[model samples]
Target: MINHGKELFSAIVPTEQKGLKRKIYVITKAFIKL
Candidate 1:
């Protein structure tokens, strides 16, 4: 059970990171446009 939980946590982390990266990219693009 502990290993399964760890796997799930690890899986979630990358998705969150990707979302964060996308947000940063959008912000940067907006700034460039301005």
Candidate 2:
């Protein structure tokens, strides 16, 4: 159960990181347009 939780956490972190990066990129682009 612990191992499975660790695996799920590891998988989730990267996807969240990628999403955060994409959001930052979009915000930066919007700032550049202004």
In candidate 2, residue 17 scores what lDDT?
A: 59
lDDT of 1 by residue, 1-34 (tens): 6775565556556657678776556556545655
Lowest summed-lDDT stretch of 10 residues in model 1?
Answer: 25-34
lDDT of 2 by residue, 1-34 (tens): 6775565556556667578776566556545655
CA shift at 15, candidate 1, in angstroms? Answer: 11
Query: What does the lDDT come to for candidate 1?
Result: 0.60
lDDT of 2 at 30: 48
**Cα TM-score per model:** 0.46, 0.47
**TM-score, prediction 2:** 0.47
**Residue 9 of model 1, lDDT score:** 57
The per-prediction tally of clashing pairs is 0, 0
Clashing pairs in 2: none
Stretches of model 1 off by over 4 angstroms after superposition? 1-18
